[model samples]
Structure formats: structure tokens, C-alpha cells
Target: MLYRDGLTREGIVVDVIIVGAGPVGLSLALGLARAGKSVVVLEKDPGLHTTSRAPIIWPRTQEILADLGVMDRFESASIILKQFTMWNADSNHKLISLPISELKDQTHFPQILILPQHKTEALLYEALKAYPSVQVHFAHEVTGLSQDSESVRVRYATNGTSESEMVASYVVGCDGAHSAIRAALGLELDGITYPLMAALADVKLPYNDPNWVFPRLSVKDVPVVAVQIELGEWRLILPFTQDESITMDERVRLSVKNLFHQADYSLIWQSEFKLHQRISPQFALGRVALAGDAAHLNSPVGGQGMNSGIQDGALLCTALVKAIDTRNPALLQPNAEMRHAKINFGVNQFTNILTRVVMLSKGRYMPWVLRILNLVLKIPSLRQKFLMKLTMLGD
Candidate 1:
């Protein structure tokens, strides 16, 4: 439920204060609430994000949702993708296809689920309503944060007007890349910003191609990644050199036309974003911690960003619950270490390689690289390993 002014409970204590209401924040809140910890989620926005940002939920993240008992809700609303195909645009030749359905014996939700970020947040919010220990405060922007020996004090404003303060044992930041909490703590995210800009759009294609699930096509030197989200609607991502002269809409239209050979698709939403591969210097600073995009950001090539963030929430929530229950803040360090390592080696490194491969596909060494990749993918064991890595299940 949306919280208002009096819900702040100034002098009262809360176990945790989540500083964002996005998927990661909500997921962490839900998990903490289910664990019987008092949670207060503070969001700057008045409502859920409407546009589709992250659309692919991998197997590992689905497992986390299942454990939270919200997988059924997601399964009812999302589309199950059984396979991912890679193709050569010039020759229309299929390079390799990873059959996700083959892993049914290993996982309950073996395949990725294509659902918008907004829908995921809605489901998590609905699940949060079942727990009395959780309260989500919308339009409450966190302005100042300070902590002493006992608890963390968070100062926030309602609609940038009335101000208030609350105290929690710990504060978690699941905010996006420009996280206010992270900045307030003087934490630095160390990594490089890619020179290329990626343009993405959700559009309704004129034709339905059932085989279009997670297809990567290289057309005219541009790398196009397309996936059928639901029904005839598809999400396309294309990486290109930065061009300030061209408008995002024009670039998206041209890219779509070049990739699909059709300009009749109806555009639902479009955006252009710069890619970054970065991780926080530390996941936690005393009683304040970071999760989701606030802690790390990676390439969108393998759809790992959102999944990693959700996983971060799962891990952080568990640690927070344990720390609160045992009254030992030391319990939080293990999770911080584990998540930082995973993001550095597991998520960041993997996505960096994929992004480099896609970017290098426009270079002179791509053909040889593709040949080697095709050869390696021919081995059943190697293919399985690759699938596991891509699905974020390897680590």
C-alpha cells in the first residue's frame, strides 16, 4: 500500500529502510518482510515505472522469485522462451541455437521469462501487501543519510516539500546508476564507460516469428539483438557509434528498417543509453549498503543486469534478516563480499566479454572469431557450459 505522512513513525524503529522501490528494492523489501523484519521502502517516484526497461528474467532470478512465492504470478503474466538463436544477417545463416528446454530436468523454470520491469515491480508490490511488516512510501525522496553507533538515520522529503526523518537498523540502496544513497556514502563505482551508445525499442512487428526468441543478427556492420517479448511485440537493441546529429527516433527507425527490412512496425517506446561496465568499490559501508544498479552496472548483451540486481537483493535481504535476527551486524559482511565477487568475476566479466564480442563483430577479426565460436559451440559439453554461463547459473 502507498504510505502517507503519518506513516513515517519518527521515533519508532524499523529494521530496514530500502531507498528505492524498483524491482530490486521491492524484491528486497518483500524478502525482508517475509522473513518478519520491519521494512520501509522509500521511492522518489509517485508510481511504478511505466516503460519497459529490463525485459528478460533468467533462470536463476526465476528461482529466487519462486523461493519468494511470486513465481506463479510472474509465470502467469510472462512468456516462456525456450530457445535463443544467433544468425548472420548477410547470408541469413543460423550460427548456433541454444535449446533452453533441454534443461527441464535441472530447473523448474529452465527458460527465460520475457516480462517488463514494471510488471515485475507490480507483482513484487502485490506480494508485499501480504506482509504487515512492510510499508512502501512513494514520492518520498531520500535527501540526507547519517548513521551513528546504533542505527542509520534517513532524511527524506515528500514531493520535495515537507521533510522528515526516520531511523532504521540498516539502509539499503537499490536505486539506479545515480543512486543518492551511494553518493551520500561517498562510494565510488569503478569501471569504464563504453564509447558506443545502444538504442532500444519495444515495437509491434507486422509479422509474428515464433522463432525470433533472443535472436542476434549482424546486419551491415551493426549488431542487432531482438527478442520476442509477448505476442507480436518485440524488443530490439542495437549498438552503434555515438552520433549526436541523429535523433533517437530516427536512429531506431533506421535500425529497425535495416534489420527487419520493414518500416511498418508500430513503435511502443524507445530509448538510447550509454553502456557501462562498473562495480561499486564496496557493496556495503557500515550500516548502509547497495544493491541492483546502485552497486553494479553491466552490458545488456546477455540480459544480465536486471537478473544480477535481483540476485543482489535476494542475497542482501538474507544477510540483513540474519543480521537483524542475531543482533550481529557482522553477519552482513559475508554477503557483501560474496555479491561483490560475483559481480566482478561472474556478471561483469561475462557481460564485458559478450559486449566486446558484439562490438568487435564490426571489426576485421569477427569472421575468424565467429568461426571459432561456431566450432566451440559444436561440442555438447561446451554448449551446456555456455548456456549455464549465459543463464547466470554457472556461478
Candidate 2:
């Protein structure tokens, strides 16, 4: 079968093969390639665009990117969020406004940087593109997979035209939630989806607050959420428009039309997203392994989806490097068991926080409940505790 470069009468083998070319896969490729491993990335997309989706870059992810020597590039194209403001929509009273200044000196990249996911991917791909050992083939989709004791054989087709096979010592699945690799490996993804389907949109608008994201809290505490993103974009979470068949455009339009009463907002992008908390049963199954959304998927409440994916890229690379350096190479086969647990734990934490926050809006006691929570938030110790949970700094 034809390999990446071309047909090799003599089968070619690589040290690692990565699926998906988003930030996660590109990050993983950079890590493995820098560690002196031969890495190839297969992307089903034709090319990356400036995606307004997932622009929030937390401090931890910034630190990781900085280590990879691309933080400056990212900073050039993003905004740093310094404050989180929560308001009581009824009274129009500011409940609690928290600034990230508290995390100063804690992380090298202390502020939350906002950059479009496409821009982030562009930077990552640029960095990895310099390495001759790493190659990325766009429009290549994995169609089949077979693994043996020694290596993994991946079957892929380009533009639905030709078939090819590539052998690799290991494979990493950084694909999104419905990962083809995860399914091909026969790994079970267990999780529960929240009753509400989220509506996400990006658009240009005139706004006064430069660094604040105003999210609409539950009016009566039913675990529903409506959040505004960046300066112009907004997100809404409500019961699926069809209860069972929520089309992306329908959900997006319904969310906007309901909130704005008129869809005057110019939409640049729209999607119906579901908040699910799920994790693969394992991270590794022999030479094939999973990372990022393939390993775990969660709600976008705290902007943890991409952050966790970046962590997956960084952590998986660390594990792989250790395995490669070990005396027995045979001991290394995608340490799925441990990675799966870590990813699952991360997902649960986000879900729990989101659920609790939503639950606080329930019932007639909301006025008193808000007062109490606000009072508690004023206490420095309590605020710090809350910050730890929200930022996952405690972990």
C-alpha cells in the first residue's frame, strides 16, 4: 500500500501516527517529533480556517504552549481576560466579580488568553512544520485499523480517491468526541448528556466591556444556561428544540431568537452543541491510544474542552517519551488505563461545577440564595477555594 510520501514496495514504518489535526493532534505531533520520534499527522479537513470557536486559553494551557515556544505567537493574536463578572439579571446587581490577578506568580502565563482555535492550530502547525521528521497530510481520513504485537497498520483514503496503508509503532487518537479510532479500537465511551443542548455562535457586535463575558444565569434554577462569549458572541443552553432531533442551525437560531426576541445579531458561525460528560473506558489499547476529545468529552462551561485537549497532548507526549526512553520498549503500548482515569476525573469535576452552579438558581429562595453565595464569595478564603475548583488549580 502507498505510504505518506509515496508507494514503498518496502513497507515503511514510523514511530508514531496521530489522527486529527486540531490543536491537540498538532501539539502531540510537536511533542513526539521534538523528542526525536518520527511522527505523521492525518487530517480529514482540507485546511484550517480562523475558527472563532474555543478562543479561551487558560493559564495552564498557556504555560504548555509557552514551553513549546509558541506562546508569543498566540499572544499576538489573542486577548487576555482579566475578570469574570456575574450579575443578578433581575436586580441588575453585580454579585461577584473575580479577577485572575490572584493567580499572579502562580503560573508563568498567569492570565487567560483568548485566541481562536483555528489561530491556535495555525501556530502549532507552524511550529511543527519546521521539523523535517514530522509530516501532516490533509484530506486524509482513517478508514480502517489493524494492530499487531509489533506495530499498527492504518488504512486511510485521500479525497475518497485512493487507499493507502501506513505502519507505525504507536497511534494516538486526538479526534473529537465521536472518534473513529476510538470506535475502531472497540472502546466504550460511557457518559450522560445534560437535558439542555447548548447553542454557540460567533458574531461581530458593538460592546462596552472589553474583557467581560456576561452569561445569563438561570431565572428560576432549572440547570439551564445562557452565556455571552467574548465581546460579541453568545451561547444559550435550553431543552433540545425537538427534544430528540435538535439540528445545529435550528438550535442556534432558536437560542438567539428566544433571547434577543429578534435575530438581529449578525451570525458568523453557529452550531448546536450538547454538553456531555463522557470518557473512553481506556486511553490505550495496545499500539493504538486515545487523547483529547477521544479520551474524554465534557461541557464547555469553563472552557475546559480545549484546555483538557491541550493537557492531553502534553501529558500523552510526556508518557510516550518516558516509554521510549525506558530500557524495555515492549513495556510501552499506549498506557490507556491511567490516562483514561485522569481524563474521566477531569470531566467529572467540570460537570459537577456546572451542575452545582445551575442548581443554585432553583426555587423561590434564589434571592436569598444569591445573597448567601455572594456573601460567601466575599470571603477571601472562600473565594480562593472557589477559584481552585473553577480553575482546577487545586488538582
- Residue-by-residue lDDT tens digits, candidate 1, 157-178: 9999999898888899998899
Candidate 1: worst 10 consecutive residues by lDDT? 1-10
Q: Pick the candidate with the highest lDDT.
A: 1
lDDT of each: 0.82, 0.70
TM-score of 2: 0.83
* Clash statistics: count for each candidate: 0, 4
Candidate 2 deviant stretches above 4 angstroms: 1-12, 87-92, 206-264, 327-335, 359-372
TM-score, every prediction: 0.91, 0.83
**Which candidate leads the pack in TM-score?**
1
